[model samples]
Target: MWWSKSKVSSISSPLPCLCLLWLIVPACEAQQQDLGALLTAKCNSWNTKTTLSFPGDGSFANVTERWTVFAPPMYSAAISPATEEDVVKTVKLAAKYNISFLATGAGHGYGTTLGKLQNGLDIDLSQFKSISVNQSAGTVTVGGGVRMRDVIDAVFKAGFEIQTGSCSCPGFVGATIGAGVGRWSGIFGLIIDALVSVRLVTADGRIVQVSKTSNPDLFWAIRGAGANFGIITSATYRLHKIVAGANGGGQVMNADILVPANMSAAYFNALQSFSGKMPANLAAVSIVRYDADAGAAGILANWDYMGSEADGRRAMAPILALNPPVVSISTVPWNKLFATAGFGIDPVLCENNVIRDLYSANVRNLSASTMQAAFNKMGTFYSDHPEARGSVLELETFPNQAATSVPDGETAYPWRDALGNMIFLFSWDASTNSATSTAATKLGRQLRDDFVKTSGYPDLSVYVSYAHGDEKIEQIYGRNKLPRLAALKKSWDPRNVFAYNNALPTKYP
Candidate 1:
């Protein structure tokens, strides 16, 4: 049995922001502090409920609870760690108590693997938000908790940039640690490719620095298996100068109405043709949506060119020729262009909305039909329930620059050399649509299964960060990387103190 306790004083103090550093301790001691007392004593705020209960708070809460969450808490315990020392203490406490813990940045993970902890300490690093640019070294050190927008703003201020997600709220460390991909792939590369180093607190509560030179094995693992290995405190990324006056077409193409009679075949053919001869300077993503108001279907095609406006026009000719788009293209600065890409989804809410399906390079062609069909079915599903906001199917193609540039064993992210990446995502308010929600989730998995069954696809290679809770350890860590990841886990986290996010098997037991 547990009881709650609270200490109140006449004078109130503001909460601390950004606690850094961490340490570990023996388990027995941590459990001695009455669970209820510990929570009531330290937790300034608390919300005890499922993700379905979170919407009422506008999606923000901070409560001390164990880690198994079927849904995100509408409220987030606002923790701002100002120093590395704070992180160390948190880790030590969690380890000593044998309590699961997870660190979150702008918490935009759509995957349940990130948000669903039954009972554990949630470390919100939002306060550690800071971005510094080193012009001479062409590097940027971003706080682990800093959001993509914060990074962009800082780098743009310093006259340089690196690839980042189109969404603004995702933290740099979490995204890159999870192999972040962005619109500038043709020129730059996936965010993981540019990563130089990371300051991490291992499961054992040891604060260590990892990079190509130090802890190479752990470094490789963190790049892809971020949460599985440790909590990254910050990341250093190699940056490059993005030429100014550079812009591309950011437009929405209505697929259902804009196309001529029965142009699905033509559309596919054109997509294949242009996609086959993808220009290095051009990057595009096609999103299908079901418009309830118009009672028709459509597509939102976002195109990007890293060089000049004129070049963007030339590069976009193939797509523009297909059909007159509803939202015509417009060019803007590379920074402003990315900002317009809509990266700023709220951290807490969107993090709970994550669900991703990964396909290997070999499966790209054979799975197109299954993928398209799934989108069509999902469109119908959403059409029936207007409240379930439209889903986003983003097909991102990686350039040879970063993924290919890095050697296979350089980092743990196995898909570095892959031709492209695709994500099938659908998010809804958990408070409502209980029946349809289950169906939509099942549909999402079915789509993945159908495509994976098709011949010519790469074997099970799921991104650890994007993994579903039901996925096996082998699925999250590819067959080959498993052994190495195991060794790393044993070496750094033998006790399995950090077994929360996409946990790696420490031993047979």
Candidate 2:
């Protein structure tokens, strides 16, 4: 048991935001004051709105849980700071106690390195879910705890559009820390590109504002490698006016196409045809996974167009020429894309605390032969291990003109030229372990290697958020940018407190 406590009523304190830290010890040490008492005793100075919870507490299970059970960070206690001041105090207190701490923003950050954080403290940022839109300023300020769905809904309500992650469950800021991407990124550029400023609490417990003029060095790093430096309390992003489509403002075309395994090659070749000159308003994602009805692995493609129905049809003419077995196209508001018609993972794969072995690479080129080889391998693997059928290989392609408009050196993110982001996601239950998990991981790595041979980039380029955690630091942050990032790391996070998820070295290796 995590904490053994005989029955007791929840404590309702007034000072420092009623903390409920009951770290009850085992029988032998029951009489004497223990960690539980110490934690409770320190609650006097916390804010009245700030709350602390332990295992077995109400809502603790849900708040502390992560989307991927694989390599989840273990936490003995969690704190939900009601204000930015509470955030600073919480950080200082955690550091004082020598407890490892990781801010939980939607808690969807999935990487094996997170497993290194055992017996840590969860700085839950859920209370920071605030959104402020300045019509006069044409900017949107969102709290750290905001999710993609929240941003989408808020922008749509305010008659503005913002770029964010495609997935609804992941935190908007958390995803942005790794460089956010989504349906509208093709036209607006990366989520980081829309960044205006950030309210940050550094590793040293100092609250500071980061923008182009203020803390310029940290601003550059925060756009890409933010998690390595500090906890972001809030971020300001430049908002764009909603463009009109056939139905109304923010309304666009959403298409779903299903291709049998036999035609996977043709589907990919058609995708490659429009690679270099992909339309500015188009975003495409294809998933290779099992289809029980077909009893084989096939391709499920989501084609998003932010323009007129005629224009969308004209743009997708080549792809529609294939005449796949299943196809659905409709006009949807850009904000509610996932809900009405998304990549189809929003409802099925959004469940929290599920084991998912994932691997990824950001490639500049797409190869039809490589796609076919991997598709066939995935099909065979699905047949061999039907229990692991939730696994999928996803390919995301968006326009690069807006992303590439910014010089590579202007920000730490070096993948402005990457055309497609590929992820090898293998999902299964706890019952499928050992040999089954091993095979899934092995296949995931092999697929990445095979794609690397034709990825067109001189070196491996990885989007840190989807990386499987086995990749070298250079592969994720780029080789040439390391020395400089390391220097910035020294100045900002000298103690290396933020060293869990693809952390940068304090000194160049």
Candidate 3:
């Protein structure tokens, strides 16, 4: 039985509440034991591997730690399945018990959807790591558990290249399923666009293959809103020959510039101008944040050019003319770009247990005045709340030719026309006062609203990957696409078992 709010409200004193919780502990333990026994028995019958971890088990404890520790989901138990068959069994058993379950890849997602899983099962997919490349077909097949770094290294060794996320730690499948945006997106396209096919376990426990020719609707839905459908066991993606650069190597020029707060207006103007005519080989990111050590706010701009140093310099000439302080500019091989892009720190080693609130906006056209106002508000927020000094506003205006080239109706991803993705990331130590975190979250939302208002954007179209869980379904997957997605959800997952991660409703609003 679930604990209802009314039952908790009857306990007037703290002492009674503690006693009540202790009294209910044994019942919860029994439930966990029964669940574990059911999973074990089902796995044995299915002839699959399963490691059932009860609540408080070290494995269970570790599985709950997400990228952001704000409000992680609670699971009665966790299971690590070794093969696709094991995944099928796990899903089937969960459906039999009428239990909701979530498939965790890298645990890098930050949405609040994970927090809603109460007494649910965690289908950990880390054991499914596999990588295979077919040079003749110019394609690569990777397991669901593979990370960006894993695929990148494997493909690089095979004399091919594929688009991947900047952060090498995120699960490759998780990123691509949401229309993965990466450094090479401008030249090649989103990781999803290169998808040849996917081997997934549907909600009904069937191992199915989805592609353009086979199960086309499922294929289109998985390209953008995959997490809502089922668990992907493996996926095949197209790869390209390595580009030629200096000395017969694939070299990319990377530039990092720091702009003073006073130059925010000028910097944005320059960025707007550069983004409007962005070259296919170039990807740019701009960040506005408070540097506590410097006791002032500033802007950082990073440019990635997939070409020789001379071509990169020529492309960046307009922005360079603005004369911001150059932090660094170097040409390195394709694989080393992740390190230079500031993703050098491993996700596990970085600071954990923090409150994070993220919001996104698609910028079709940049308004300098609107951006300047947002920056000024950020300055005020940083000044007033030192605890949130680490917060940042990121504007990514990469060359999205390959992404935009695809017709809007072809996939569930609706932000193809957007030239820039604006992310307002606010964070603070979880140990900080709750009020501080609350204030920071409010400020982030306010900033996003102000940006939309100032920029004259018609609607609130947020990137589903970066959403904070408060956005409407239509906003994430455009208004026109929601009805179809809802219909698909009703057909594929009638019971709504995969109702995590900004879930789509079976019935459209």
Could you estimate the TM-score for every candidate? 0.80, 0.93, 0.89
Regions of candidate 2 where Cα sits further than 4 Å from its true position: 1-38, 42-44, 243-248, 342-344
The superposed Cα distance between candidate 1 and the true structure at residue 316, in angstroms, equals: 3.2
Superposed model 1: Cα runs more than 4 Å off: 1-33, 39-70, 73-79, 243-265, 342-363, 366-368, 429-433, 453-456, 507-509
Sorted by lDDT, highest first, which candidate order results?
2, 3, 1
Alpha carbon lDDT at 350, candidate 2: 78
**Candidate number achieving the greatest lDDT relative to the actual structure:** 2
Q: Write the per-residue lDDT of candidate 2 for residues 1-509, one digit (tens) a residue.
A: 34322222243454342233433334323322232343455444668887767777886787798899887888777788999998898777556555577887899987888888887778999999999999889888989998878888777888888777776888989999788866566678899999999999998889999999999999999878889999999999998887564334687788989899778888989988876878888888888989888999988898888876778888888899999978898987777787755446687757888888899888788788888898999999998888899999988887787888878998888788888888899888788658779899899999999888888987778988887888999998888889999999999988888978889999996
Q: List the lowest-lDDT window of 10 residues for candidate 2.
A: 27-36
Worst ten in a row by lDDT for model 3:
1-10
Question: Per-residue lDDT tens digits of candidate 1, residues 1-509?
Answer: 22212222221334431111111113344442233233333332333321111111332353222122345432222234556766776677567555565677766554555454554456767657777899999999988778777777678777776787655666778788777866665567778888899899887778899998998888888877777777788889998765544432222211112332234344445555553446666666555555455564555556666665566667667556766434445545555654454222224223433333222211334244654575566567676656555455555544445456667777677655444455556555546657756766776676667656642446644555555556766666666677887888888888866665677776532
Error of 1 at 437 (Å): 2.4
The sequence of per-residue lDDT tens digits that candidate 3 reaches over residues 286-306 is 888886556888887788898
lDDT of each: 0.58, 0.81, 0.77
